[model samples]
Target chain A: MTTETTDAELTIWRDGRFQADEWTRAAEDEAVADGPAILPLERFLAERDALVSRNAPLGVSVEPNEAIEELAPHLDRVALVTLNFPKYSDGRSSSSARLLRERYGYVGEIRAVGDVLIDQMPLMRRCGFDSFAVTNPVTRKQLAEGQWPDVPFYYQPTGSTQQAEVPAGTRPWARKPS
Target chain B: MYRYDEFDHGFVAARVDQFRDQVARRLTGELTEDQFKPLRLMNGVYLQLHAYMLRIAIPYGTLSSKQLRMLGHIARTYDRGYGHFTTRQNLQFNWPALKDIPAVLDDLAKVEMHALQTSGNCIRNVTTDHFAGAAADEITDPRPYAEILRQWSSIHPEFSFLPRKFKIAVTGAPKDRAAIQVHDIGLELKRGPDGGIGFAVYVGGGQGRTPMIAHKVRDYLAEEDLLAYVEAIMRVYNLHGRRDNKYKARIKILVHETGAEEITRQIEAEFVEVRKTELLRLPDSEIERITAYFAPPVLAEKPARSSAFEAAKADSAAFADFATYNVTPHKAAGYGVVTISLKPIGGIPGDATDVQMEAIADLADAYSQGEIRVSHEQNLVLPHVALDDMPALYAKLAEHGLATGNAGLVTDIIACPGLDYCALANARSIPLAQDLSNRFGSPERQKEIGELKIKISGCINACGHHHVGHIGLLGVDRRGEEVYQITLGGSGDETASVGTLVGPGFKTEEVVDAVETVVDTYLKLREGPDEPFLAAVRRLGQQPFKEALYGTA
Candidate 1:
């Protein structure tokens, strides 16, 4: 749950806890190498050939207002997509995550970054976000302790891997009358 | 009435526990007030003028006698011995401690009720025609579909943090008693050309500071695509709905700013993608399962002409008035729908004491097949009273001060909780409604006026739905004084229209006279008493009414 002190360094959280930091988020005009790197969508598009030739894990950071369809053709080459929430109230990224998983059929990890509050984690998880890059220490502690309030069952079916399958005989409304 | 299945029961119970933990966190100072406000609002708890107001949703206004009795119990145990029924077919307890909310929610959960999504930026409680199953003109019962929407929208992953609060209303009948045209999304059940049921979807309709009637987004959408289509609509709004301005953040503003044609285009595009997924599709079996819960109760047909009913009506003029004004024709042959008026002379429009609620519950159990409905007009309906038992029911209602015989009369006003209880109100709507009720309290005078709807709101938020009122009054604060602004020619039915403002506003003391002036003008302008006030206003524009209100032009 504790962060290493480094400027502009990114830590990846996967499967429930923080994993090792390996990918370096590339700055604009940074040279590509045969190593893990996360690039902005614009920079990724500019250096798509070099990144593809590198033959390593690649990720792209997407802005809230960016069209998700622009990354549809590149989904096969990317391993992760980071959806940025400028603020918690701006919900465009949630829709973007759904489009990526359900529409584009992208199987890579989708992480929510920036102002990632603990309360919205459940919702983010429901919308195909597998991980959250939380910046707040208290929220990070809560997430690590599994103390965030979570509702196990859901009313709507979201195409998320973490979604619990609605049990049979529970949805009696889906049964034929005798 | 739709009963809760095991899944529905478990879902509500889990929601209660989740909210209890959230409340505990707020109390322990783990969550700040800003963080706790949305959670509390989602659970229907509000910090009002004096104390916490807990709004309990009576879904689509349908309530079992047992549930009503529980509401009565809660009123007596945790709050003042009274509750106010709102225009949205919910009940609000105006006085409660914040610490008691979890217990209140727990009690409601025991009765298969919870306040989840009753407030919040998410989808709210889905409302439908109060007389859905009993109304003779209905094409099909709408409660099933409303219940479906309620389930789909509850804790929806993507739409929870919407631009603003969204409301959905459904109606199966063509007559539109549910005020479908003024909701964020209005669904009208219609029979397609192939004899299959579908919905005529309307989007972007709302009544607030800026009132706009919803436009038809889909002429005919298949029944199986209900959730998918709604999800498409929500997606479009969630992505592009304005967030910078709270006042202009409603879906109505979105639909208005983005041309309805363009919004429809985007929704259709979104629907193409959404309908392909199994995520939101309504399967035939699911529809059948939900529909089964709303199957109408069997009642043996009785003679159309009840000699006891006729004799009782002939014997008592008061009973005749109640039969004429308070009873509506039921779909069942020998039964009638009875509206028990909560608006007595000089009384608050929708407040009922614990005793009255308990009495109504008893009456519902005895005569109405244990079913009671809360109408948007702030009255309760006993949906299955036998014609032969009208006299006995009327007698009991009279004893409980519920038989006012003013169902559609001028005295049956729909008003909001203005400055009296609401924190957002600018003036007091209850006092104005009381004054108007007292002035038009005479039964004979009310009968003569005949079906003049006077809706008053204390602010521009339009919780009172003043824009659709036949004669609307809006309360505004002006330079430390409360002034009332009047609107004319509003109706909330099939031909829904926002009322037009009638010149300047009136001072508090002068507002009642101004209302009287408008009513007198309508009386003078009408061809006869048979033509109701709304019809007269529609036929003859607002010019004459304006002249009468502010003198000749």
Candidate 2:
């Protein structure tokens, strides 16, 4: 439910910087695009075999609350998994991304799309999102200007910031430098 | 009592910088109100009826004299001259502008305090027994665990966006003064069969429109497993709790819909997987690190009896009443825990002025080891005062109008800042509390009906904790007129139960009489003077009180 549904360019940011986006979002009523493109989960599930056989860097977009178990078995084929925030307040996809990473062991790039604001970058990243579809102009400028949300330390070990070793005596179990 | 380390200091300073930026963006209209709401709430700012209100955390109800004085400074500078102590043992300033919040936070951070996570859907300020390190009956100090939780839950990623706000309470003593059973997550500190520290965990207990007592999930979880077990529970709740309806979004509803056994099974399975991560198994060194911050202050031992206290009581009846009502036994010899009551006859329950706060700070420095605690019951406790200082402390407190001599009596009511200040309130509650206090203003009458708790909430949200009050009053609007609904027999102690609704409703003008009538009925029906109001209600049940309220044929 983002109010910003204006026609705008969608830029994909990944691996420390924004690059030319190879993935195109296919319009629902139109015929499928030729190159690397993402389809809704239902279309992907319905045309699984055909799409898998002719795959050219295929991806699948999921609703925020969609059951991730349905997409778990198809993890081997997809090059990217797109999770939606819908709005900044709706956070079911964080759970979905974690399930994909920790439960299904999906290694493909998981990109956060829709209502991807600047403030949620760190949380969205820590919840296993490796890429983001930058449509929000403010967030785009924020990302472009090299400003980012980086704290001195973190409390929990999840996603990218897991504490792999025991910390020192001064601050153990906590104070994992980020 | 925990002091900020270098890391903590840096984090707080960084957070203040971030919030200041957010405030600048908001004022410049770069961030919409909807976008700014959660951000402001995360920093403990709320847009109330007239202006923004700020809530500062008093972690686990523990406070130092310097920190208390800082709060007074904030009250005097940024807010109305007064601050209200909330049921969560936090402080709420009724008036703080949105622009002023960043500056307010700066002042707070200087004192090693911040308003972080005091509001919003994050794990709120970790509350525990106010008598944590000083109570005579405490098995271990719960503040260390509470501090551990405060750190772990701060800026938490997954849980920061919970379905609904979560509350957790911990208690070291078995008496349950922290109201553990009513929290979303309750941890009772205890020793296991191996004589090692552990916790008895309870989950999904809360009071709101639908109140349910928490179910015990684990009888004994090792102290090392505290964070891991709690993380498992939070994950289970975050994934499965219903999000379709806001009212049913609490973990309590999830625990209710999914049977306790099934929820326990899910949590246990999650715990097995989460413990594999090894990041949260609290090391003994970490526990010791936090526990050292709460080490009790050294006190010189004295005789078992203080002749000065005895002689002062003999000299003045007022001192005798104050000694009898406000003082409780301390774990240290010849020391007493003094409760500085905020409630006065026909006055606000928890409102303390900046002057009064500074006075408490001065007195704490003078008499109580420079340590103070904010009780959940809306009173302040001086944790370690010598018995011989009773008269002097009472006199100084009296000069500042802080000595009310009603710790657990009728006048010591817990009333939320209802329609007077809160935008969510449906009707007025503080007015009714004022009226009731005046009606029972007589010390003789209050002493006769000893240890009665009257909690009032302005709405069904139950911010006043009326559901756990021995006598609860809930305000409702009936056809544009404010009225009240009464509930009885609720107890928040170890024997926790939601109060049963008594029948009918009373007008605003009549609520005071209705409460008096209920009290008088209890006085008549009691087995004797020794039987407290709650005990009589439990023995006789709601039928007798119901008959007395509406009258029987």
Candidate 3:
């Protein structure tokens, strides 16, 4: 018996289907890509002045334990912030995402990477994550078909403009439609 | 009693469909078992020792006759012939197959019930006082707030993936029947100094490897800011709570390391910011809409004195004993709350057969205005049983072995589904409970023991709530053999305290006798019979009890 499976290829997705891969990842020793480069958080900090002066959209990939406070001041200069799950069970990144949006008022994109599961996407969206990096085959298809568990009613407000996408007809924190 | 509106129905139906597809993917090998574990757990399906376990939430312990009847149906059709009511006011079917859970959830949704967050790392089913709406001493019905929290926390986007499982309990009355002190968040409904609706908020309380009583973070939080305040607390825990060590990750530890005063400041700052947004502000109209569902039911007026009730008590000593122990004062005139004890001598503490469930549902419909409640004590309650109908209700309950007259007495033990069913348990709690039950089975012995709570857990995760039991029995595995540890002077009421550990552990064979010795010692040294076990323990301390147990000098 044969089965289809996802490859090591990673594609950025926003507004549902897979989008253009405009962002390139830069390692510490690697040279920056021409257009937009997502750097490790530590690398971004070390190269803060040079990276910021280049005028290309910059993103920083953050680990779970790293303090989001480090990126707080740099949020305006940064065009995108990438958070890792490492494993989906690790929830620290969700907090970081919320802090970026709710606390720091970061308007740039927040993307989820690594071990991203379909079950947790709606929640990730609410934590101010606007895009996801999809490599899981089943998740890729599920997202393409718009088949995530959609709970329209909400009892809390978040920094992201989520309800606007689905139009839940709810006031802030109002679960029941009035 | 809160009927699901169109929004509620749509949400649950969609969730059911979502889970059904998830299950299908798991079965077809499209999803790995590792991948499927959290999803299944989010839907309240546990991969237990023998078979899969499904926990169905009875929110705030309130159940309609129809909802309970559906549980019975799930028990018979999808599981074994029985279900176990848990310490968190939920029902667990121990033997449901993974393939059949979607069907079971479908049946539940038909009755406006679903096990949305009964497990996983999410905020669990919010529990409240069992006699929430009907207790005579209640200042306000807590079910409304519980229902509100239920809606707010259901698949909560930001807070579902917490550091650990979080629990919240609310109590309407100051008596604290829900054991608010041992939960992650405990809300006591109280009128503020100006007589406005508010909650005395307590945070960081939990019972696990480490038992801590929640500190009163805010003495008077306005009702409108309930969700905002809780959101602030959740955010703090979510961000700062230790995820490196799973064992020390609960909010209790955070409160311990950071100190209560410091944590309270952080929470207040977050609360101030969140409250300004008006995101989760509880409008009076929404509160009123939810509160209306829990309003006391209208009933035909009758005299306070029921001649038939009096006659039955006089005629049958069994009925008299039941009336004395199992019945409590209800808020409404001529009404009483009836506790149908699932704890019978030598039987499991909270197992109810499908037939018993169906019969209790019938009784609720006929006598309780179709209302039923599941207490955290593992007993079923008929919240609005009239005095005129008490005897009749008692008679029907007796037919199904449901009429045990030991609501809070020695025989009404609280035990976890230990080694018999749980993968985490070190010993068997149910058999030990049965042994104690048989030892103190008689009404004479139980009445003499009087208002004693004997809570047993097979392990320290404290699902059995041994930390707050009046006489707590904790089973520990000593070099691979089960030995029990004894703790004294614990209470779960308004004045909650963790039990102090006494000297030494007892062998499994001797543990029952050890408990008996403790009880006998209480009986011997009490100031008077009027002084209950807890009061005497508090006054005398564990010195006398310890000396009696180990014959220590």
Candidate 4:
């Protein structure tokens, strides 16, 4: 119900990079960073054996539930590909992060890097993401409004996304036998 | 008949407000067409050939006179004075402006109605037999269960975004009036050996680019497990059903590829997990609470048959023909169920003008218990009318142009809007249906050829249920000229199958005569009056009919 209307007013950042309104060839440019670099999932998969040989943690964002058992062992330290909201309706990336965490059991840092509508932060946490990179700039009041939608951490197993075990008497779908 | 309590009414009002906001956003350019499309579709608004079509859910095809009167108001104020009933026991309005939608929804909300999940890839309005509470063969009314499903599935968070739209139909009677077999999920209610009511579940049956019969997922799922079992099946489909191709996304294809056994095994595993939770148990008290809302109306003790009504039927051939064709047996011995044919001879099958709707609503209030139900066959029913009041009711209906003496006869066709309103249609179905009705307009002639189902579709989508008609007419455009392909011997009842195509296609002008030829041949070859056209065609095949039509076998 907040009255702020412009997308430029809210600013967010993820993975040590500040999201900006302007774009350049560098944004689209592919280069190997000297220290560490984030990459798309397909590119990482293309160079997986080489990266695995070199033991480098290549970062990439994935679609929802796009993981296989084979990708589990190598993704422990790699930076995972997350959403930049090409479209809010496109939920492929949310599924991607969940699959990586639960199905592959990846212990790496999960980041919400792009077009991460600040309102969805709690949902992001519930879906197993530990960190968020909010890109929309907001006033202090706007930031407060965009902080979180609801309580985080769903206690039950759902879809391809797994969850942390629930505390006693907290999880409602779970009931003791009569 | 399920009355909305305060909670239900508040929820519906909230939904209307949410949609009003969505519409505002779209109008103000805050949302684009792509973003709005899914939102609108979820609300049952579709952008059709000329204008937007709003499909209102007539849950289990049951309606009160007040609801019909509201629809009549919509027809007059918001639309072009009519509403078209679809095969799914829902009504579709062809023209409503984008801006006026919110107002229309607001008006509908006043009557405990909303168009939520009427379209879109989620669980749709759960349909059941139109004669749900009143059918003679029913073990129990299916509407209460359908209402429960409708409540459970409406805007459910986990199930809102599915790979494709889903349809479910349930039937309580042994005779399947709901056409359960051709739906995405078909449930036949049954009494188990333990004397508990349960369901036999069928999944994957659908009609579209690929027509499929549903596979049995479970034979007897207890009533308490119904919601959970349904949830399990949907979860499996949501997680594993293909999304890469629209045509292969239906549960039918998933069942075919993974095999029904594997699908059922997966669902059973999920069902076990779901049952371990507390949400699956719908208490008997809760079931009874829902059922109480649909309790039968109070009946005044009266004679089972009216000698005055019988004399009137015997006095006039028209009245007798109307009574013979339109009236059906009531569950209560003293009353009768009347089907007021919306499809008058040579008129569109399911189109009713605003005035006609008002007239029927008045009749419903005066005679029946202020209730009206829409049949899947696109006819309206006054489910419980005293036998003594039928003649007066018929007289009233006749004045409004709704007293056609053809309910299940040759002229009582199930037809689609076709090229007249649908952009996807290759030919016109309503005109063809009108032509056929005109050819066989005589009441005696229609009575002689009794209990035949003739379904016509403008295209292969089978909106008119042409695939399951005893005599099916499919409109196809051959080299840019409209021609129809005829199929025979199909049935949509407990024994359901796609009809086989017969001979070559006929031109638009010749289709009606061709249908006549087929019916005339059936009349000549049938062994007795009990054998219907479907049975006769099945027993004798299409060889003799083809010979009679084309001069050689």
Candidate 5:
């Protein structure tokens, strides 16, 4: 009934925080230390059960609303949710991550897993992502770009205002098509 | 024509230096392609199908002859002898190497020009009616306001990374020649009841996969609050716009999702909040100062008609045809705005050589008021040419291959640099365009056909704007062979609509014949010669053309 989460576990664990600068299988394996193993969307679909960890559940990341039904139920057992942004130009993953959180009610740690840029962090954060798995091995200077004076300045009454300091009482995402 | 003050010059110089450093870092491998891709695109450099393409901004389509010559110089020195004038009224050099782009930009900076925000997901170049000042029906020249917007939006700290690219167009005339309806943000300049100039803002209109006419956002936004209102709209789009779907990222999609009324309300609320501070409104004197930069040139008092021009028109049929087709009415009485058609019959639409560019610049200085407008339709405009100077101007233009005598005629078609240049194209568009122009080359025939626009885009990307042509030809590669698709009855005016596809695709060689058949069908079906193909299509749907096209197939 009680779930335990720690700050140190989520801060920076991928390849000891900054080991491999590329998307390698070995690097990804080492990165997932806590809840469950994070597999690419393609691998999970092929052999979902076999890839599961002995101690933790297996979590898969898929592109936008592709197979939400299959991935939603596994969220209860899975601990880490990593979405793959195949390319910066490709935005399908961003939508998929949002759907996983808001529509399917996924409570696990959601992360942006690939082709991440410093400027995109603000946008990624606003789209309901809590954790970011930096794949590019960005320097400290690049990471420092996370500071914007006042982001989420304009709040839409319709969608998620997770990045903004919206009041807890008012749920922006709750408003349906009126 | 907004003169770069110390602040403007300082800002642009700093931006150029930053880009130059970025380029140096990229070349030295300090920055990889992954890292430099966004940076390069933000500065309007794209690694297209073949080599790199550098898009230089022609702010509001207004430039002094000096700036125009600099573009010509860039073409001669850095690029393949010619430059392509794009629909966005910018000049793009196709062959500039990645390493040389910074130098090219530096050269442009020397002429007070840069390619900032010409591409990428940020706000792109602000475009306006080519005949902004010269149009007879204009309430107020929209270029001054457009220039102000250009300054405001250029490398703005916020709204740099929008969900998608945004395009804004302005028109001072009620005739709507700028295709304002199809732009992401369309502004129509008009004088209010108080005699103060304001803008009619249209939102969410764009011409791509999901083409929609932008709904009117405000009846009138005061001239002073223009920048603030624009900022408010940009803020709304940046925050609320769908980031997940690239296709649904444009403000048009948001306007569609939330009706125009709701979007307008949101924008108005934001504008009110932002305008409370003095951040967005330009002082009346500042607007006047900007407007003074584009003040009408000293025009001599001359007769509206010259007997010599009439004699030349009568004696030389070629000159007569040129005068009839190329000349447009000017706001000034004794002057006529001339469009030096770059779409010469059987030639590339926008490929003016270095010499041609120089000639155009010289002609602008000598005949016009020292200002030249690069029309979005890919033609050079002599804004305030005296009627008496027509013969001399015509002679000069003829010598430089600029006197095509076809402005809005079928031969003066708009065609993108298709497969020949662009990497994304499915088939060649320029060649097809040339062939069609050749087939309809005769001035007598072109004049007989009257105002007809034939736009050809190589692919569905619609860079060539084929979707909005009266007779739209889209080239697609089928089974490793070039195939041309025809669309009929598309227009980008106030009543903007994407052309509907008609019948199956045609082979590369048969395209000219297909266009001929369509034109002939229109000629036969038109109420009269006065009824243009577009108007005919609008009055009576595409059934006639569709039947004529596929009746024998």
Candidate 6:
């Protein structure tokens, strides 16, 4: 796993294009700082009271199999939730992202980190992932140029607000395509 | 058949463009074979034994005359002048250069067809009863719901990367002609007590190495909750289905390990949350709109029986045999459903030549309201043919060598493209099927035997569906040579059950003899000539056949 220094300044793709990343992910056993920080769910739970006492924004990092119910009560305080994809084929994180957005109603920036590929970007975006931490240089460059393959229309309604462009009065639940 | 809307057209067109780009990237070495494999599979391209096999979805077995002609065109222009229709109601072109795939897809798109999700760890082609709209016993047509599911599961973001491939089948008739019992999810449309449409949902049924029948998850699910409930099932499977072992990754294993009641509880719990979301809930108007597209064609009611059809049958014995065995009663008056057997004597079961395809297409336009349906049993159905047109259609079909009057008899065998074409096969299946067809080639003898399903699988993958045949033959390799194991009493219809092993095994040459012995045993044990082989096997357990095969097992 490649690691970047906190001071190197990172960027993430959110909504449609690249933007400067806001929260910094704290290394293991690192103390909470004055700026926004993202910590693993285990570490946050271990030092919750102490982190809650601080005034800075806080977030939690979740693994593919981690339960979102554990993070539900703290959703109000957390502004970002990062889900890790250890491998591209292990798709547990996609379901976790949807659970956070649709089931738990967590209104926060859900970021996809690790092993994110250009082909999966469209799917991840549809599954309630608003931001992506692309580590692959080629995918990062592609994201920067907005050159990833995408279909403007979708068959299923997803976490995204975009509606399908079917005829009016055909389906009440259909979202009109923008 | 349901026509594609502008949205569906755009979706498939964009997918074609995306796949073209991916193919280019793979050729340029920007993507490795490992990376390109899944992408190509999602578009229904497979790396077969000899070459890339492209499987195109027929969308619940419904095809228009124009679409059938397009497939004929693909078979002639791009492939080896032939196409194989699969059990999933799809067509496979076994020989096509990878460079020409994009062009083939362009042709398919012109006819409102695609190969999307035909092969992959995703929701595959949604199959249904081939006699969907025209079956006399059907309560309601299931194609509309199948179409709805097709749209909902297409490129599903969350479920696309599942642990294993998923298959769903729907049937509106009480008879399980679609083999609903052997699918991951099987929906049986039923009318509620209050006269509203609902579904009897079955989950976790599949046929492979570990063959198991499905368990009913819901006795009745409202039609409006179809998408939400299906998504709920998918979500549960996506999260809890085992990713550790590829062999045990199907939802069947998960249902087996977790218990059906427990899985149902989880699905209901998930449904509580899923149903609340407007994104997943299916609206009534949408179902209505889809249902309108499949509305039965208007047919003028004629006399119940046709004089011309009877006269033709009386004049010719071959026509009489064809009419008796190959034709099914249609719901519309004076109309009959004709099943043109792809399994001619001593021929590949589902393979059709380009000329045969074009002939079938022309016959569909002339006799069946410009519609054709592919049966899961590897036959083609003209669902609304007028009885008066039967003689002409039969004559045309005979010219193409497709007018085999053995639809449900001994010669109507279903065999997968085994070692001859498939890389995963252990032994050749088509040869055994051909040998048996020759052994029982006589139409008189086939009629005497009556409605025997002999399904052969090349390997344990059960692609040939041997597990559900009345006399099933499973080809296995024994000490570097081909051997076949026989099973009896399997059926893939409303009373679906896996067959039981009759005895040990047989050499390739003796396998056909072994099958004959079993058929001869059934012939002796059957109460009357009217009793079918499956019924006889059911009446008397495997004991009689086992004794006949192994001398005292």
DockQ score for model 6, please? 0.56
State residue B283's C-alpha deviation in candidate 2, in Å: 0.4
Please give the fraction of native interface contacts (Cα pairs under 8 Å between A and B) kept by each candidate: 0.56, 0.50, 0.59, 0.01, 0.00, 0.66
lDDT of 6 by residue, B132-181 (tens): 99999999999999988988788888999899999999999999899998
RMSD of each: 2.9, 3.4, 3.3, 6.4, 9.8, 2.7
Residue ranges of candidate 1 with Cα displaced over 4 Å = A1-13, A28-35, A46-51, A162-167, A170-178
Q: Cα lDDT for residue B483, model 4?
A: 95
- Residue-wise C-alpha lDDT for candidate 2, range B102-185, written one tens digit per residue: 999999999899999998777998899888898899999999999999988988877887888999999999999999999999
TM-score of each: 0.96, 0.94, 0.95, 0.83, 0.79, 0.95
Model 2, backbone clash pairs (residues 3+ apart or across chains), number: 0
Q: Estimate, for each residue in B1-553, the C-alpha lDDT of model 4 and write its tens digit.
A: 7887655676677667767877997899976786678668878999888999999988889888999999999999999999988788888999999899999998888888889889877789888888888777888988888988887776554555566888999999989988898888999999998999999999988866577778888899999888879888887786677777877887888888999899999999978866766455677877888888899889788777788779889888888887787887878877888898877888999988889888999999999999999988999989988888888988889889988889888898999989999989999999999989989988778888988999999998888888888999999989999999998987778888778888899999888888888988898999999998888998999799889877873
What is candidate 2's TM-score against the reference?
A: 0.94
For candidate 3, write residues B405-513 as lDDT tens digits.
Answer: 9899999999999999999999889999999999999988898889999999999998998999998999899999999999887888899999989889999999999
Error of 4 at B57 (Å): 1.5
Candidate 3 vs 4: which has more TM-score: 3
Ranking by TM-score: 1, 6, 3, 2, 4, 5
Q: Provide the TM-score of the second chain in candidate 6.
A: 0.99
lDDT of 3 at A25: 89
**Clashing residue pairs, backbone N/CA/C < 3 A, model 3:** none
lDDT of candidates 1 onward, in order: 0.87, 0.87, 0.88, 0.77, 0.77, 0.88
Order the candidate numbers by DockQ, best to worst: 6, 1, 3, 2, 4, 5
lDDT of 6 by residue, A64-154 (tens): 7777778887788888999998877777889998888767778778989988988887888778887888777778776777786767667
